[model samples]
Target chain A: MNILNGSAYPNNGVHLNKRHRKAKLFSMLCSLVTWLGVALLGVLLYQVSSDGFKWLDLQFLTSFPSRFPYKAGIKSALVGTLWLISMVAFIAIPIGVATALYLEELSGQGRMNRLIELNISNLAGVPSIVYGIIGLAVFVRGLALERSLVAGALTMSLLILPVIIIASREAIKSVPMSIRHAAFALGATRLQTARDHVLPASYSGILTGVILALSRAIGETAPLIMIGALTYVAFLPEGPMDSFTALPIQIYNWVSRPQQEFHQLAAGGIIVLLAVLLMMNTIAIVIRYKTERKYK
Target chain B: MTMGTFRLVKKDCINNRGTRWGESLIHCGLALCTLISIVTTFVIIAILAKESFGFFEEVSPVEFYFGTRWVPLLEPSSYGVLPLVWGTLSVTFGAALIAIPIGLASAIYLSEYASHRVRSIVKPLLELLAGIPTVVYGYFALTFITPLLKTVLPEIQVFNALSGAIVVGIMVLPMIATLSDNALRSVPDTLRQGAYALGATSYEVTTQVVVPAGLSGVMASFLLAISRAIGETMAVTLAVGATPNMSFTLLESIQTMTAYIVQISLGDTPAGGIAYQTLFAVAGFLFLITLLLNVLSQWFLNRYREVYD
Candidate 1:
C-alpha cells in the first residue's frame, strides 16, 4: 500500500507540471502575437516617416502643385481638407448636441425614443461607403450639387453625426441628477437649469466629443471619394461649389502613379495628414481628460 | 404699494411661463431634427430603390444575383454581380482572418494581464492605428506592403488583394480590440474570482470563462469589423486592381463592389443612365447586407445582455 501511494504521488506531480507548462506556452504564444502586431505598426510608421521626411519642408507644404514631381505641393488639398472639416464641424455639432440633449434629458422613455436611439446606433455601424453612395445619389445628383466641396462636407457631416450624437449622449448622461433637482427646487425653470447649469457642466465633454467626431470625419476617404474629390486639383477651391481635392485623395492619386517619386509624394502627404489628425486627437484627449477630472 | 406688489407678482408668473415655453420649444426643435434625420434615411432608401428599379428594368434580377460574369462596360454589358460579390467576399474574408486572431489576442492581453500603466499607454497607441486615414493605409498597401510581399512571393501582382486586406486588417485591429476589451471588462469580477478559487490557470479562466461570457459583445465587434471590411473603398480601390475577376488567390488582383461603384462614379455615367443606376443597385445590396448585420448584432446583444446588480 505504501509503494502504490508513492507511485501515485509522482504521477500527480507530473500531471500538475504538464498543466503548468501548457499554461506558460499559451501565454507566451499570446504575448508573441500581440508583439507582432505592434511590430508591424512600427514598421509601417517607420517606412512612411523615412520615405517622406526629405520632401516635408515648408515649400512642399505651401507651394501649389506643378506638373513636375519635385515641384508638386499639396496646398490645394490641405486647404480643401481644412475647409471641409470646418464645414463638417459647423453642420454636425448643433444638431448632434440638440439630438443628444433631447434624447437624454427631455424625451420620455417611450417607443419612439427607443426607435430613435436604435436608429442612430444602427446608422453609426453602416459602412461609410453606403454614405458615399447616398451622397452620390442624393447630394450630387438629386440636389445638383455636382462634384463640389459643399457636397463632400455635407456627406461627411452626415457620416459623423451619429458619432457626435452618441458621444454627446454619454456626456449628458454623466451629469448628476441631483444638480438638476436642486436647480428645479430653487425655482429655476427646466430651460434655465439645462441651459445654465447642465450645459455648462457638460460643455467640455460635448466639445471633446464634437472634436473627436470631426477628427474622424477629416480622416474619412470613402464618402469624399464617392462625392468626387478631384484627383489633381492644381489650384485652391474658390468656393464651396468648386471642385476640390483633399489630402487623402491627393495621396491616393500619387500612390496610384507608376513613378517612385509620386510614391514619395504620397508619403509626404501622409505625414501632413497624420500631423493634422494627431493635433486634433490630442486636443480631444486633453478636453476629455479635463472633463473627467472636473466630474471627479 | 398695491400697484408695486401686483406688478411684481405678474412679472414672476410671466418669467415662469416663459421658461416653460422655452424648454418646450427646445424639446420640439430637437424632435424635429430627429424627424429630419429619419426622413433623410427614408429619402435615401427611396432614391436608391427608384434607381435600382430602373436598373432592374434593363437587366434581370437573376443575372444580378448569380450570373458568373460582370461586364457592365462592354458591348454586351452583362450585369452579373457575382464577380464583384466574389471579389468583395475574398478580400473581406482575408481581412477578417487576419484581424480576428491579432485583435482578440491584443484585447486579452490588455484586459487580463497588462498592468494599469501598460494599459494606459497601449490603449492610445492602439487607437492611433485607427486614426490613420484609410487613404494613407491605401498608400502603404500599394507602395510599401505590396513590394515587401513581392520579395518573398514573386508571383504577387502589383495591385493584389492580399496587401489591401492586410493593411485593412491593421487599420481595423484597434476597433476590434477596443470593443472586445470593453466587453471583457464588463464581465463580473466574481466570476473570475470563482475560477481562481477552482485552481484554474489564468489563461484557462480567460479563454474558457471570460471570453465565453463576453462572446456576444465580441461577436458584435467581429460583425461590425466585417461590415467595415466589406464597405471599404479607397484602400481596396487603390491597391486591388480594377479587374473584376472572380478568383481566390490572394496574390491576384481583384476589384471589390465598392471599388467598382467608385470607378463608375468617377467616369461620366450620366444621370438616369444604366451605369449610374447600376451604382444604386449595387449600393442597395451593400446597404441591405450591412443593415442586416447591424440589426443582428443588436439583437444578439439585447438577448444576451449580462444582468448585474
Candidate 2:
C-alpha cells in the first residue's frame, strides 16, 4: 500500500509539472505573437524611412514635379496640403469650440443636448470617405465648389469637427468651476466669465486637440481623392479654388505606377507626410506638457 | 438743482438685464453650425436617393440587390451590388479576425502584464503604426506584404484580399489597443484582488472578472475597429484586385465598395453617368452601415456605465 501511494505521488507531481510548463509555453507564445506584430510594424517603418531618405533633399522638398523622376518634387502637393490644413482649421475651430462651450456650459442636460452629444460622437466615428460622399454631393455638386481646394478643405473640416468638439469639451470641463463662480461673483456675466477666465485656462488643451485634429486632416487622402484633387499638378495652387494634389494622393499615384523609380518617389512623399504629422503631434505634446506643468 | 439732477441720473443707471443677447447669439451660432451639419447629412441622403432612383430607373432594384453578377461596364451591364458587398464583408471579416485577437492581446499585455516602462515604450510605438498614413500602408501592402505572403503561399494572387486585410489589420491595431486598454484600466482593482484571494491565476482573473466587467467597452472597440476596416479605401484599393468577384477564398483578389468608388474616382467613369451616380449610391450604403455601427457603439458605452465610482 505504501509503495503504490509513493508511485501515485510521482505521477501526480509529473502531471503538475507538465501543466506549469504548458501555461508558461502558452504565455510565451502570446508574448512572441505580440512581438511579431510590433516587429512587423518596425520593419515596415524602416523600409520606408530608408528608401525615402535616398531621395529626401532640399531640392526634393522645394522643387515642383517634373516628368523626370530625378527632378520630380512635391512643392505643389506640400503647398496644397498646407493650404488645406489652414482652411480646415479656420472653418472647424470656431464651430468646434463654440459647440464644446455650449455643451459644457450653456445647455442643460436635457434631451436636445443629449441628442446633439450623441450625434456628434457618432459623426466623429463616421468613416471619412462617407464625409467625402457628403462633400461631393453638397459642396462639389450642389454648391458647385467644383473640385477646388476649398471643397476639400470644407469636407475635411466637417470630418474632424466632431473630434475637435469632443476634445474641446473635455478640456473645458477640466477647468475648475470655482474660477467661473469667482468671476460671476465679481459681477462678470457668464459669457465674460467663460471668455476671460475659462477660455484662457483651457486654451492650451483646446489648442492641442485642434492641432492633433488638424494633423489628422493633413494626412487624409480619401476625401481629397473623392473631391477630385489632381494626381499630378505641375504648378502649385495659387488660391483655394485652384486644382491641387496632396502628398498622400501624389504618393498613391506614384506607388500605383508600375515603375521602380516611382516607388522610391512614393516613399519620399510618405517621409514628407510623416515629417509633417510628426511635427504637428510634437507641438501638441509640447503644449499639453506645458499646460500640465502650468496647472500643477 | 445740480445735486438733484445727478442723484436722479444715478438712480436711473441702476437698471439691469439678465441673460445677455451676446450669450444668446453664441448659442445661436453653435446651433446654426449643428443645424448645417445635420442638414448636410440629410442633403447627402436626398442626393443619393435621387441619383439611386435614377440608377434604378435604368436598371431593376431587384437585380441590383439580389443578382450575383456585377458587370457595370459591359454590354447589357448588370449592376448587382452583391459582389461588392460580399467583397467588403469578406475583407472586413478577415481583418477583424486578425485585429481582434492581436489587438486585444496587446491591450491585455500593456494594461495587465507589462511594466510601466515597457508600456510607455510599446504604446507610442504602437500609435506610430496608426500615424503612418493609409496610402503608405497601401504601398507596403503592395510591395512588402504581398511578396511576403507569396513566399509561403505561392498560389496566392499578388493583389489578393488577404494581403489587404492583413495590412488593414495592422493599421487598425493601435486604435483597438488604445480603446481596449482604456476599458481594461477602467475595471476596478477590487475584483482582481478578490480573484487573487480566491487563489485564481492572473490569467483566469483577467479572462473571467476583469474582461467580463469591461466587455461592453471591448465590444464597442471591436465594432469601431470593424467599422474602420469596412470603410478603408486606399490600402484595399492598391492590394485587392479590382475584380468584382464574390468568392470567399482569401487567395483570390476581390474589389470592395470603397475600392469601386476610388476606381470610378480615378476617372474612367464619366460625370453624370450611371457609374458616377452609382458611386453615390454605394457611398450611401457604406454611410448607413458605418452610421449604424457608430450609434451602436455609443449606445453600448452609455448602457454599460462600467465605471465603479
Candidate 3:
C-alpha cells in the first residue's frame, strides 16, 4: 500500500490485512491437507500391523498355504514373488538399458526419435490391466506359456519396461558430454566411448531405475492375475514354466473370500508385501541420492 | 627392441580388427533388445484387433455400442457394452472428484509453502504411498474402507462403488500431487515476485499467477489420474464387485471394463470361445480409451508447456 498509492490507501489497509489473513488461513488449510495425507499412511500402517502382527511368524513365511488360516503359510507365494521379480529383472533391465542408450546416444531428435520418445512415455501411462489383457492374449494363449511364471514375468516386464527405459534415458542423458569426448580423443569409437565413459558414469542411475521398476513389478497384481497366476498354489513353482501364486494375488484372493481368518491373513500378506516394496524403494532412493551427490 | 616393437604393432593391428568385429556383434544384440519394446506395441494392437474382429462379427456394432446391458455369459447373451462403459464412467468420475481437489491442494502446499526440510520428509512418504501394491489397496478397501463406510451410511452394500472409488482415488493421489507439484514449481519465481511487489498475498500469487501459468500441466495431470483410475482393476474388482449394473449411484455395486476382464480371466474361458473373445473386444475398447487419454494428456503437456528462457 505504501509503495503503490502512498497515504491514499491507508484507510483500505484494514481490509487488505483481513484478506491477507484469510489467504494465510487458506494456505494453512492446504498444508494441513498434505499432512492429512501423511496421517492416512500412518493410520494404514497402524491398521495393517494391529491386524497382522500376531500371525506374522517364521512358520507363516515358511509353510505352504493351507485351508486353515492358522496352518496357511506364504512360502509358495513368497518364493513365487521372488522368482517372478528375478525373471522380470532378467528380461527388463538389459533391454531397458539398451533402449535408453540407443535413444540417448545413437538417436538424434529426429521425427522418428521423437515419435519413439512419445510412444515410450504414453506406454508408461497405459493402464496395468491393459497390459494384463495383452499378456493373456499373447503370452498365455498365443505363445502357449500356459499361465506359467514365465508368462506372468514377461507380462510384468512389458508393463514396467517403459518406466525403466525412461529412467535410464534420463540417467544416460545426465552424463556430461565431455566425458564421451574424452574417451573419443583416446582413439575410441562411439561404442567404445559410450561403454567406457557414459555407461559406467550412468550405471548407478540405471540400477536405481531398474530396482524401482522391479519394486513396482513385485507389487503388481492385475497383469499377473490376467495371465492366470494361480490363486491357490500348494507347492512352489519348480521352474519358470510352472504355475505360481504371487503375494499380491494371494492377498487379493484371501480378501475376496468370506472368512474373517482369511481377511486377517490378507492383512499379514499386505505387511510382507509392503515391507518388501518399501525396502526396494529405499534402496533405489539411496542409490539415486548417492549418484546425485557423486555427480554434483 | 625395434624388431619386438614391430611385432607388437602388428599384433595391435590384428587386435583392433577383432575389437571392431566384437563391437558390431554387441551393437546388433543391443539393438535387438531395444526392438522388443516397439514390437510389443504392435503385438498388442494386432492381437486385440484380431480377436476383437471375431467378437464384432458375432455381436453387431449397434448392439455393442448402444446396448444398455452387458451380460455375455448368460443365455441370449446381451453384449451391450454401455453398462460397462457407464460403470467405468461413474467410478472414474467419483475417483476424480475425490482425488483432484485434495491432490491439487497438497501439490500447491508442497510447491509454494513447504519448507525444504518438511519437503524431503513428505516427498518420500508420497512415493511410498505410490509404491503400495494395488492388491493391498484392494484388501484395504474391502477390510477397512467398506466397513468404515457402513458406520456412516448404515445401509451401504459390502461391495459398493463408493469404497472402490475412494481407494482408487487414494491410489491416484500421488500421481496428481507429484505432477502438479512439478507444474507449480516450474512456474517462474519472477512471476510470484512481481505479484508480491504489488502487495498481493502469497495465496493471491499462487492461485492467480502460478496456477494459471501451470494450468496446462495440471490439466494433463488430471487426465493421467483419471486414466489411471479407469484402468485400475483389482481394487475395483474386489470392492466394486462384478455385477454390471448401469446405475449412476456410487453406492451400488458396479463392474468396470477392467473388472470385467479380471472376472472373466480369473475363470477358465476356453480359447476362441465367445467369453474369451469378448474379453479382447473389451480390451480393445479399454486400450483405445486409455491410449486416447494418454495421447491427449501428452498433447496438452507438449503444446502448452510453459517454456522459460
**Fraction of reference contacts reproduced per prediction?**
0.59, 0.39, 0.70
Model 2 docking tier (incorrect/acceptable/medium/high): acceptable
DockQ of each: 0.43, 0.33, 0.48
Q: What is the DockQ score, from 0 to 1, of model 3? A: 0.48
User: What's the lDDT for residue A102 in model 3?
Assistant: 70
Query: How many pairs in model 2 have backbone atoms within 3 A of each other, for residues 3 or more apart or on separate chains, i.e. clashes?
Result: 0
What is model 2's native contact fraction?
0.39
Q: In candidate 3, which residue ranges exceed 4 Å CA deviation?
A: A1-14, A291-293, B1-19
lDDT of 1 by residue, A48-158 (tens): 999999999998999777668899999998999988988887888888888887677755566666877888888888778888888887899879999998899889988
lDDT for each residue of candidate 3 in B252-301, tens digit (9 for 90 to 100):
89889999999998888888999999888998899899999999999999
Q: What's candidate 1's DockQ score?
A: 0.43
Location of the lowest summed lDDT over 10 successive residues in candidate 2 chain A: A1-10
Tens digit per residue, CA lDDT, model 2, B180-292:
98899899988788766754456656676777889888889999999999999988999897999988788998999999888888784566798888887788778889888
- Clash totals for all candidate models: 0, 0, 0
Q: Pick the candidate with the highest TM-score.
A: 3
Q: lDDT ranking from best to worst?
A: 3, 1, 2
Q: What is the Cα-based lDDT of residue B11 in candidate 2?
A: 30
